[model samples]
Target: MISFFKKFEEEGILGINRRIGEYILPYNPREYYPLVDDKWKTAELARQFHVPMPYHYGLVNTFGGIRNTRELIKGRPGFVVKPANGGMGNGILVITGESEYDNGSIIFHKADEKKITEKELYHHVSGILSGLYSLDGNSDSCILQERLECHTFFREISFRGIPDIRVIVFLGYPVMAMLRLPTKESGGRANLHQGALGVGIDLRTGTLTHSVCNDKIIHLHPDTKRKLSGRVIPCWEIILQMASRCFDMSGLGYLGVDIVLDELRGPLLLEMNARPGLGIQIANRMGLLDRLRLVERIHDPADGPKDRVHRMLQEL
Candidate 1:
């Protein structure tokens, strides 16, 4: 037991308690959490900073709005329905396509290939409005967002759902990043706990180095059977700069920025997390202690977003 603990200490593995005490509590402010907690509010803030995000068709705040879900979508072949305050990819519904019946009622197809009627879709929206999947379990609003097509790079490696990049930024500097690839087991959602794959990415270069699933290291994707390493992320610099800019936008010293590559839109910000999980360390086979300390010691508040990204990546 002693040796096990000593090894972890030598490796600088950050445990949960240390993460919250040393990073979250000291760097993140309570007042600024709301900006990232509510997806709808984050969209409004993204517009102010000119940060690109998924297009929102509309929001359903009340149970009555659930009845208008179809009208709000306005015949979009593909769209996403999620709670404004949801977390961990819960309360998210993906409508991949739809066909109308002869009677004019629409039948929707989910990403999983299950068919859903208009009534079932409305019920899901109503559940979101009731906060069934919300972070705080309070009444929540439902967001109707544009479903982005998978980028070609990810489509080659991922199983079914959209793959997204998770960037950990501290003091406006990007310290580490991971590519979250959706898997069939995860129901096509890029969530690690749901069996999605987390691939470590080099901060300086966009090349993938290592991958982990269910806390175990692996090279080939479980479902796709493709080699996970050596794949370089396209538009790497732009993604880093955009993630750094989010810290400036949210005013959170420690932050997690989720970005997705859209086939048409390039990189789009999904949302920000003030209390990002520590699973990134496992994916990268590294600890956040050294990087966090470096940021605390050398970060220049006067530097612009681009400068912060360049300087930090070089330093790391």
Candidate 2:
């Protein structure tokens, strides 16, 4: 048991203390946080930078604007309602389909076939505007984003919700990446703590190599029961390029870029995280310290996004 921990330490498994003391504290500045913290701001910045992302319907900023929900998302066949300041996938309501009832009310269905009324949907969005999901009880807004359809390849492995790729970028280079797949236990949300499966991806090959669920290594998905390893992620190079570009857009030295693959749209940037979690180490069964150190040693401060990605692929 001690040797197991010793090997982890020797391989540079980055602990929370080392992450903060070494990376977050020195590399990330407070001012750059807002770029990734607020969902709306992140969307706007991605638009300004020409980063591909899901189509945004509109924002519900005030109580009065809540009435515009129907009109805002009228033509959107499917949409995601989420708090602009929410984290860990909280307060996110995904409406996959809608139908009108005889009483003139609309019914929305979730991935699990759970049905909700339009009034219930309005109340959920109202809670978001009331700051129910915000980090510090600050006023929040509701963003209506286009729902993404998972690529056919992932649909076989995922139980319900769409899977997303998380690429950790350090010094403008993509150091590590993992595929976050939603599970029945996670309520179809791609969050590790919520019981989602975190599968490690080969940095150069884009193939699934390892997987973890509830901190235990697994070879098959609990719900889908499909083999989790050896599957190749679609749009692998494009996803890494998109993640590398986020460094310039957000100006954060250490960043986590979340991207999703839409069946028709290829890869789209979903969100960004300044303080990315450490579960990725468990998924990869390796420490992030070594990968991060490699980035620092090879990354050039003057390299552009394209040059940085090229250098990283060649050297790392």
Candidate 3:
């Protein structure tokens, strides 16, 4: 056990303290955090920058707004309710579908097959307004966004949820990427700690390379039992392009760009993170310190997204 741990240290596994102290603290400015921390603000910024994201119906910022949610989302076939200030995939409610009865009461179907009523939905939104799931336990805004249909490729590997790609971007260049796949254990949420699989992808080629679940290495998806490597991500270049552009949009030097592939829209920017986790190194079975240091050395002002991607590939 000691040798195994030593190997991890020798490989330079990035810890949270080092990540925050070295990369995040140095690159991310304090003033711009609200743009990414608050989902409502993030959506507004995306609109101004023409970055594609899930369509939001409206925001419920107060407890009173919760009472009006049913009318707001009434016509939608499916939707997601999330706290604008939430983190770690908490306080997110995905309503897959709904049914109305003769009494005018509606029943909503969750991804996990549990049923909820309109009143219950309102209550959940109220909880969000009270900051039950926010990062700092402060009053939060609740947003209802259009539910995304998973791309065909991920639908086969994921179980009852949409998976998203996480690309770690440094100084306008995408350095590392990973695909987060939801499993039954995550209750249909694509969160790593909730038991979703993290599959590493080649930065240039978007080819699957390695995977992990519950912090343990794995090669096959738990539910699909399919090999987790070699599959190419659809719209790979577009995904990286979106990630690269986020640097200018948010002004964060080092960031994580979360993107999802919509069946019709292709790749959409789900969100951006000022302090992205260091799990990509674990999933890729590599060290981020080296890649980060290497990226720091090669800074060319003339490089575009395509140029940066090509430069990395050429060096590889």
Candidate 4:
């Protein structure tokens, strides 16, 4: 065990214990955790900061609100139902489309084209409200969100779901970034733990550099067979600005800003994670300790979001 830790430090990889004690614990205050943990709260903060995010169709907190699920999604072509405090993509239901019949019976289509009835959808929301997927064992509210269309760039690379870019911001300076692509095994969710692909991005050029799945390196996508390198991310500068601004909005020195590209809207803030994972190092084939140490040495508290992003791009 001693030698194993020695190897981790030799590689400069940020282990869980050190990550918490050095970065998360010191940079992230416990009081501001709710700003990032609860998706609804994050959305409210984004509104105050003028940061773009997915539209909130409505909120379903009570079991009684579950009855009006159809009303929540009335005029929309598709909608997403998810626990506001859920993590790792658990208890997320995406309804792609719906068809109404003369008898008033309607059928909903999932991302997989699987049909779901209204009763079944209500049951799923009920389960979310029961704290089944919440981070804590407490009742949670469900967020009814507008289903965004994937940008053309990601649609060609992703299997059947949207891809999101995760930028790790330290003291309002951008440090590392990775693009998470969904696969069939992940049920069309851009979550790395559930068999999705984590592709590292070049912070300087917004280009793809490396990729990994389950900590194993791969050059081509498992299903698409597309070469997973050299593709440049669109709206890269705007995305970085949004990520840096989130630091001010949330008041957390260290956090992960998840952003997605919409067909209409260029990039929308998906959510923020105060305790971001370390798998990003494996995907980038580089340790985070050096980059983080560099940021700590030169990060300026007086600089604004745009200035911070510029410095990181030039120096990191």
Candidate 5:
């Protein structure tokens, strides 16, 4: 079943790219993303816009910097060490807390048995510094960010790690949203193709629609068998507002805004994608071409950010 779906996805790549072009009309992924993919710039924008983001402790941009990673995270119990240039949830370590091993060594547990020794952690950071996670084998930076406590709304569904809300903002209006739930198969991460569930969310009501797992429609979770519908996401208004604001901030006609509901901080912006995935269409069981056309007719990028957000709410 998985293989069949995998082949289907591979076959649909061209169609996916075409749809993205249709939705993103004037913008091209290769042109915009490469320019905005800089992690430091993204963080600065989020901060300037009052978009809550995880607290970054330090960044390791060189071999000498990697040597200081342990010292940087010495007292921080819960934090995440990630590669700035990594894609598809790769090279991310979510330190749950701390633990003492039988060998009298301290270790950090990320979910399940995903533990890392001090030496292993150093080696991993070194690998990132050496360009293992960067595009074109270029040297990379490792960012250590404060681990957010996942909100209770996701406790029942998520296995570990933070599950993000992906909002597809078209021309400064939020057109669609999907709650990506993490699972054991995804190593407690929310990459849907890795066996997580993509639950479509109604923008107006904040209620869940049907869910898709591995490209197959399912009413219940594969692991928990919990019915997928009727799940109400918290902070729906804030999520939509943040997504719309990104369009104004970046002057991009279309984009995806990833937000996570932190237990203490409420909704926080994780990252912005110039070209979001087409799987959101499958999850919503709707076509992006139609939604894009509708939003384009309604939204005016010339409008100020506050007015644009109000216009989006009215359109919704």
Candidate 6:
């Protein structure tokens, strides 16, 4: 079934739809830009808007920052070291704590069950510093951010790493949202194609509808076997408000806002993706062509945030 879907995604109706969907959705790859592409700019904007992001110690654009990584992480708990210009869920390290291995080698605990020796972690960081994770071959910056604890609500569904809420916000209104689940296949990551499940959500009710994994419909989790429906997300209203405010913050007509529900921190903004994935279409089993058209017809960027939100709720 997986192979069949891969083939269909490559050459069947699904493939064609993906191609057409890009043009139909205003926030498709070509239409949106990445906030992280410019590390300094991203930091400035995030700071200006009071968005809660991982605490950034320093950015390594030159050799100086890379050389002082030990100094940056000194006394800090386990933190995430990632490339500022990376994408596709690559070059990210989630450090849980510090420990020593049986072999007396110093290592970092990514989580309870995952550990990476200091040598290995340094090598990975070096690769990111050398631009292995950047879109182009250009040199990149590595940022050390505070690690966030996964919220309890997602404990049953998420394998590890952080489970983020990807919200499709159009014209300052949220149109669709899905909780990206983590799995072993995704290496504790939440990318949909990497074995995580995309659970569709009803925008108005904040209720789960259906879930899709690797293009196959799933009524229950493959690992936990828990029913996927009736999962009510905590802080649903706050998440919606944050997403709506982001449209004003970014000034972008359309965007995808990623919010991580931290165990203690409530809802925190992860990052904003201007060019959100079309895989959401398959996940939700609802084509975006009609919705995009609707947004285009009713959307007015000049609308106030409260008014826009009120209008959106009315539509729901």
Task: List lDDT for all candidates, in order.
Answer: 0.92, 0.91, 0.89, 0.91, 0.77, 0.74
Off by over 4 Å in 1: none
Q: Each model's TM-score, in the order given?
A: 0.98, 0.96, 0.95, 0.98, 0.88, 0.85
Q: Give the Å shift of residue 118 in candidate 2.
A: 1.1
How many pairs of residues collide in model 1? 0
Sliding window of 10 residues with minimal summed lDDT for model 1? 63-72
Q: How far does residue 43 in candidate 3 sit from its true spot (Å)?
A: 1.1
True-structure RMSD, every candidate: 1.0, 1.6, 1.7, 1.0, 4.5, 4.6
Cα lDDT tens digits, model 2, 1-316, are 9998788789889888888888988989989898898989999999999999898899999999999999998977899999998898989998899999788989999877799999999999999999999866888999999999889989889988999999999988998899999999988999898999999998888999899999999999999889988888887888888999999999899989999999999999999999899999888878898888888789788898888888888976
lDDT of 3 by residue, 174-221 (tens): 888999999999989889989999999988789999999999998889
> What's the ranking of the predictions by TM-score, best on top?
1, 4, 2, 3, 5, 6
RMSD of model 2 against the true structure:
1.6
Candidate 5 local lDDT, 84-163, one digit each (tens): 87766777777878877788887877764577787788888888888787755787889998888889888877777678
- lDDT score for residue 21 of model 5: 52
lDDT (10s digit) by residue, model 4, range 1-316: 9999899888899989988999999989999999998999999999999999999999999988888777879989899999999998899888899988899998999986789888888889999999999998689999999999999998777988888999998999889999999988888889998999999999998999999987889998888889989999999999999999999999998899999999998899999999999888888888998889889888888999999999888886
Q: After superposition, how far is residue 179 of candidate 3 from its true place, in Å?
A: 0.5
User: Which tens-of-lDDT digit does each residue in 1-316 have in candidate 6?
Assistant: 9998875544422244553455325444442355535444566777898867667877666764566777778777778888888776788788878876688777788853677777787778788878898867577778888888888888887677688888887778777788888777777778886788898887777788889888889998777778878989998988888888887777665677888898888998877776567677676667555565566677876776666666776765
Predict model 6's lDDT versus the native: 0.74
Number of the top-ranking candidate, with lDDT as the measure: 1
